[model samples]
Target: MSYVALYRTYRPKYFKDVFGQKVIVQTLQNALLHEKFAHAYIFSGPRGTGKTSIAKIVAKALNCEKAPTAEPCGECAVCLGIDKSSVSDVIEIDAASNNGVDEIRDLRDKVKYAPSVGKYKVYIIDEVHMLTQAAFNALLKTLEEPPKYVVFILATTEVHKVPATILSRCQRFDFKNIDTADIEANIKKIVNKERLKISNEAINAIAITSEGGMRDALSLLDQVVSFTKDEISEEDVYKVSGGLSRRFISELLQTIYQKQPQKALDFLNQVLQDGKDISRMVSDIILALRDVLLDKIREDKKYPELNGLTPPLIYAYLDILNELQQSLKYTTSKRAYLELAIIKMMNHQSIEYVELNQKIDALQKEMHNLETRLRSEVQVKQVESSKNIKVQSKSNLKPLVTVSEISEILNQGDREKKNLLKIGWPSLADYEVPQLRGVAKLLHEGSLEAVGANRMLLVYDDIITAQNMLKKETKEKVLKIINSKKQLIDDYTVLLKADWMILKDDYAYQYNAGISKPKLKEIDLHLYEQDEDSIQEVKLEEDPLVEFAKASFGENLVKVEE
Candidate 1:
């Protein structure tokens, strides 16, 4: 004459009794009616979703004399045996306790025998993922080709740990967490049956505490019921559960709205003094603040999933209190943390929240102010630089290129006179070669073709030679040269283009490697393949400085071998 816990007392005995598992129940039922059940089935999902319960139901449906029936008659002998867990044909194993390879081998041996009492022998293994690798291997062969009269039902909370080979052999069904609404409805039925006068709010609190686990929810209800034989109160539920009252939490917000830090701390201190846990207090606060935050947004189904808690209250609660969660463990003094948190909110101007929204607003304002100041500073610098440039314009204009007198290199000769103009005295091409420091030298000397106004092209006498010199590294360096100098000529629309107008016999630089023909082909093939599916075709445009990149690397690097 011992009391059966509420969860077990109300455990689903038939498919019609299982809550929030209609989808899974329907699939199994259909499979049963059609005689299409798999030899091995894997049921995987979160806790309390009834993986084992469904497995048992399947066992019952299969073993019942009249089945291929969706609703197994609990009155039948086979159903009664399964209900009592004494069915010879149905064996339930906890893989967590018996996860050794030997256990799996033993099960495999047992599965080969014919059903002793029913049409099929069903083995339901819970926590199947806990089985060791060798156990999984041992189970796999049986799964692949089990006797027609044998069924293996493997249930697991974590399916990923199950080996792919085993998984590949079984039919997998993922169970989902039961919704709060479903749990709440069931709790109401229980309260009605027990003849207890319970408030909707107290029932909800229990549902939320259960966190979608029906057994936990019912166990909690059983505990709450023991407090009073005929009735349960919300206060009694709160006191027993170690959770904050929704009103106490709602009042915390009223304090925040009123901007009363002292009063708020006093309320928080009273709650802690009443034996309420600070972590649980913070958790309650976070939930309240989240509700408050949600109030400012759209309402989703998750709010209803909160049992009986109202949406607006949850919104207000989650908004203001979720803040204290991270800082909860840092303080030994719970009242002090509450005191500090409330005081900081009271003086929003002085608080430093690294990621706080208030601080973010202030920081954004600060950023705008700083940006305006930086822009003013940059403008001032530019003006001063312009003034300095005017003063030095005359001196610097003396064609600072040391070889400025060599008109061919500068490409700035006298077009009208048909001869290179000499400027800056002593035939001015002499401004220190303007150091085509990077691949600017290659462009200056002539190698690829400038196909776009934005491109620096280098063209050779033969296309093969031009493509050959476009080594991956060399192309990158040349691109940097084109972009950098093009930035210098702000208004001119400067495009770099190079052509070996004359195969210069005078320029000679020996290359250590062979033609590098193989490397060139690989590079072209790689780049070409990427563009083969679709090409960005456009009218070819010209750039002016590409002659420099090809030539700068040395004449042989770009010019055809003559």
Candidate 2:
């Protein structure tokens, strides 16, 4: 007799023998025990996850001579018949080949007949998603309301392709990929039972390569056992599976961390010479990086050579390798792509450092330009002071508007007018009126804080901006511009932000304390004005350095000091 593969030889006979699907086993057993099982059921998951195997076990349990048992009696004639696929009542259909309306129509017609030798006739359809629309439509009605003695078990790896109409009628069970630990334990049990001479490292390599598939693991084990007569080793597994050993992967990563491009390339060339797959090598490296990342996050010390690497660096390495892995699929020059990825990983830090240095240089140039502009402004102010012009010092500057005026405006502030003026403030920066250009520039430097009747208050971040806005010529031009816009403001004044905040707080305290408004006073507004000649019109020229700073960083991040 031909040798049976391990997967088939160790195929689960009873629910208890099924591995890595405890929840599914228990649920099906309970459903069978209570006799409340659905007439139609769908099993969906990855391949080799026991979807069809469990379906067959369910058929055996339903048809076992001792009826309604959770665990089937494999010795019964009906159980033995179903196991051998000799039972006429249990039919397993491969939907990939028989997916058509004619086949489903035949099934619909045959459902009316009674079971041949068992109490229930079970129909197990594999890869049910392969069925065409017409076939699904033909099966829908019968699947929803099948005969009492008929059971339909639909299994598919890609459940998304299955129609909602067909899915809605059946009870769906989603099988998960078997865990690596569980797969490892199962492989060990098989090895011990078969008396196969295999090392633990070989078993682990098989389990990891399987990627959570039990059948794949067992199939790999069978191949490895056939290849080697002596005790199997990890090297044997890697050689057979076209995978890089973990030690080689660790050494490659260490060379990368040490920034030894030559050494890393040497390792790559060696692997290629050994006939290992380039894409598989990249995948192994990514997996090794993943392990290092987890160790770093968990504060564990597993890879000492990788101890110098940071999480962010590992993440970047993974990103580069992952991109290379994707690009390898469509490219013929796989070696060139892998070489380029290794070089990128080696120079990642240097590249990031260069970029950071460039940013710092730009910021230094901006600061120097700012300092030069401030010094020039200081010189102009000094020249004005020599002419005996009354220029208020920033620290000792007084508010242009009196406390009484502020109190009167705040007490009777118009919410609607203030909101309107606030909305229109941004437009002043791009004003087209030539005569009001300087006024627009000054107003744009400050913000409209309050509006009362025909009076307004503007606040600025610095004393220089407030003083310039309060200059006699700037204020007159502003009034003319406002009148042109039909705003008709009687007067406006400027104050520093710090002073405004204090005044605002005091006013709020008085209002909340129910204090009455102060008596109105007709004070001379000329006291607040500065000589027109002393405060020159702000130039409209755009500073290229400032613009560059704004463009390099952003407008919101760049601030003009003066």
Candidate 3:
């Protein structure tokens, strides 16, 4: 006799032989043990997950010589006949080929007959979702009210296609993908029984590649056994399965993370040169990233290449690879797309670097502006003192909020209210009031630092921008827009990013040291409002070109050559 395939040779003949579906097996056993099994059952799940195999086992359990038993006695004539497909009473139908109203009608006509040999007659339909609407309709009434001695079991990988009308009439059992460990153990048992020369690594490789499918694992193992002459190795599994080794994947990820584009390109070229599937390589990278993400969440250090990487960065990597996977399907130049994806990931690191440089430049400019303004004010003070005239210099301008007010706001900060403002802040750019929309747009230059019961803090990298946002007209317009949407905030203030950082650090230090916060009096809103007359007076007095020259050339480099 010709050698049978491993999957078929090791097909489960009894309930005890099935693996990785303990709950389903136990439920079926209890139902059978009490002789309360349903007349019609629907089994659904992914391929090779035992949906059809379990259906067969159920058929044997119902028709075995020892009827109503949880485990079928494969030695009995009825069980043997059912297993061999020789029993007239146990009918296995491939709905994919035989799905039709006439075939179903014929089945309906035959449901009235008594069992030919066993105590019960069972109909097992595989891929029942393939049945046409008319066919399903034909089987509906018979399925709903089958004879006592007759049982119907339908199996499909896609249960969503199964009509609700058909689903409502039968007991549904969803088979899950078998766990990898269980699949590995089962493979080991088979190897030991067959005395196959295979390494543990090879077994593990097969188990992972199968992706929770027992039939797939066994089939892959069979292919490897046939391809190898001696003891099977992990490399042999990878070669046969067209999958990359975990080490190669790790190395590739390290190159990508370390921003070594040449090495990444070399890895892709090697994969292409060796006739490996580019799409599969992308998929494997995604799976590796997924593993790294899990390790990150669990606070484990399994993937060292991803040690310092944050979850968002890993997600971005996965997103790039995922897009590559999708693009590979449409383009014939798979290598080009894969190469582009590698470059994209390597370049991802530049985004944060660019933003950091921008913030640094903004802070430097703001510092220079403040320095020039302070020097101008000092010169003006000297001029005024020489003339013996009282004048209010810009240097005398008060901050939008005092330290006490900021402290109070910090003490009264509400996390929930802050989150609400942060979430809604993005919408301010499109405020309904067209006149105030520009003012609202200016707020986006900064960030919502903290929100309190009645006060909100905005922080900007540029001091000038922060000061502009604090002006009475801009502040009023922004407040109007914000209050029109959400009436949570009654007042708001702006601070330089540097100042906000200092305040945040201080707040954290004080709170951690268990210092009791003192309640300060409510801030006077009028103090934050700039007087238009005072601003016009200062602008008229200060020389615009002198200010610009001071900002452009350093204060030390510029001279008053009047």
Please write out the lDDT profile of model 3 over residues 173-273, one tens digit for every residue: 88888898999999999999999999998898899999999999999999999999999999889888888877788888888778899988998788778
Query: Which candidate tops TM-score?
Result: 3
lDDT of 1: 0.64
Best by lDDT: 2
The regions of model 2 sitting more than 4 angstroms off are 297-304, 349-562
Deviation in Å, model 2, residue 206 alpha carbon: 0.9
Better of 2 and 3 by TM-score: 3
lDDT of 1 by residue, 303-384 (tens): 3333334344344434444566666667677667667666665554423232255557779999888665554343333222
* Sequence-dependent TM-score of model 2: 0.63
Q: After superposition, how far is residue 540 of candidate 2 from its true place, in Å?
A: 56
| lDDT per residue (tens digit) for residues 94-202 in model 2 | 9999999999999999999999899999999999999999999999889999999999999999999999999999999999999888888888999899999998888
Q: Local error of candidate 1 at 22, Å?
A: 2.2
Predictions ranked by TM-score, top down? Answer: 3, 2, 1
The superposed Cα distance between candidate 1 and the true structure at residue 542, in angstroms, equals 65
